[model samples]
Target: MVSSISLSIDSDLDKVSLLARAVRALCEDLLGPDDQDAVELSLVEAINNVIKHGYHGERGKDVQVAVGLQADQVVIEVIDHAPPMPAQVLDKAPEDTFAFDEADLADIPEGGMGLALIRMNMDEVEYHSGDSENRLRMVKRIAPRSQ
Candidate 1:
């Protein structure tokens, strides 16, 4: 069986936490306790990117959160009305550009590292943009193998 829920909210950093909490609850219930932290952290990072880069610091734009459970996997998607993330952004090697220090965090640039964290925590990550919408989908595998 598959279960899903979606919500649209203003594009704001503060709102990302709410999205994370909602997604985490769905994942925990559907996917079980294993990797719960990883799922929550990934969702938080993805929602942060949707608010920051996707919306380009704009206010009152819609950020959509969708969660789904199918068989042994949990999928979460964050959709925004803004243009898709640059291919280079997603393609870049996390080791090279995502390494951040305290100084870097203090002077946070317009972009860096969030997607890297999302990639690291999720089992699969995909991005799609067309028809005036951008979608970032992440999947986590959840199932126990019998010995």
Candidate 2:
């Protein structure tokens, strides 16, 4: 069986919580607890990036999230009309380990970790933009349920 849900929200940060909850509910049975949490976290991170960076903190802009569960995987797509992601960000690879200067508190970055988190959590990640629309797609593989 397949299940899916879609939500459209304004570029407000407050709206992301409710949207994440809806996606989690829709995916409840299709994923294990850990995977479910990962998906929710990834979903939140994706939308946050779209709102903060893509929309430049603008309100009332449109952001859409769609999640679908198939027999073997979960598909998540986040769409927006804001500017496309930086070329370096789109081209960079996700690192398995996080590296930062522990001794220097100011060296820690306050932002720019969302994409890395999404890429680390999801099995696959892709992003593209054209026609004034940008889309970020992520996938997580799951084992088939036993009969």
Candidate 3:
């Protein structure tokens, strides 16, 4: 069985909290505690990317967020019309995320960690865009429910 929820919000950062809360309330019963947090954070990163990289933090763009549960996997999709991700970001493989040695950790900057963090939390992440809509999706698999 599959259950899902869909909502659209402006690109304003302020509405991100409302979006996250709606997604969480819809997903809470389908995901375990850890998985719920993973989905929430991953979705936030994806949406923020669309706002930051795509729309350049503009507030007028419409962002569509859809979250669903399919068997043991949770699915999240973020759609926007801002712009496709930059070529540099598209070229990075998940394994290419910044690696910090104990000493290098102190120099790690903020902001750029969004994509890496989303990849860390979700089992699968994908992006697609054309002239109008850019789509980002993340999936996380959950342990089987104890019967």
Candidate 4:
């Protein structure tokens, strides 16, 4: 089975929650509640990164989020027109899961965990930069709903 929905929003942080809610709703019947939360969180983090880093928090910029259910997977693509991320950032995969050194509170960096969070939640994460735009694609496997 296959189904998809796309939503467009200005690069404003406030709008992200609304879009996330819509996405969570879309996944409700197809995915379990916990998976639904993962989808929402991943999408939120991806969109937030685009708005803050890609658009430099500038409002009115174009951002599109598309969620699709194909077979036993959920595919999400976050598209934007801002500059693409640096190659180093895009190439680095989560080799070792994120661990916190609770030993020292000051040791942890402030922010910069969006990509990690997205990667941890989604099964597959990829980014493509085109001449006119950049796209970040994320996919998560889901159990097929019983007929």
> lDDT winner among the candidates?
2
Select the stronger candidate by lDDT from 2 and 3: 2
The RMSD of every model to the true structure, in order and in angstroms, is: 2.8, 1.7, 2.1, 1.9
Model 3 C-alpha lDDT versus the unseen true structure:
0.82
Q: Model 2 over residues 56-144: C-alpha lDDT tens digits?
A: 88999999988887988999999999988889876655662257786898877676678889988889999989999999999988967
Clashes of each: 0, 0, 0, 0
Task: Using lDDT as the measure, name the better of candidate 1 and candidate 4.
Answer: 4
Candidate 2 least-lDDT 10 residues: 90-99
Rank the models by TM-score, top first: 2, 4, 3, 1
Q: Given candidate 2, what's the lDDT at residue 32? A: 87
Please report, in order, the local distance difference test score of every candidate based on alpha carbons. Answer: 0.80, 0.87, 0.82, 0.86
Highest TM-score scorer: 2
lDDT of model 4, residue 14:
99
TM-score of 4: 0.90
Residue 119 shift from truth in candidate 2, angstroms = 0.7
Q: What is the lDDT of residue 113 in candidate 1?
A: 78
lDDT of 1 by residue, 41-82 (tens): 888887777777777888899988888888788888888888
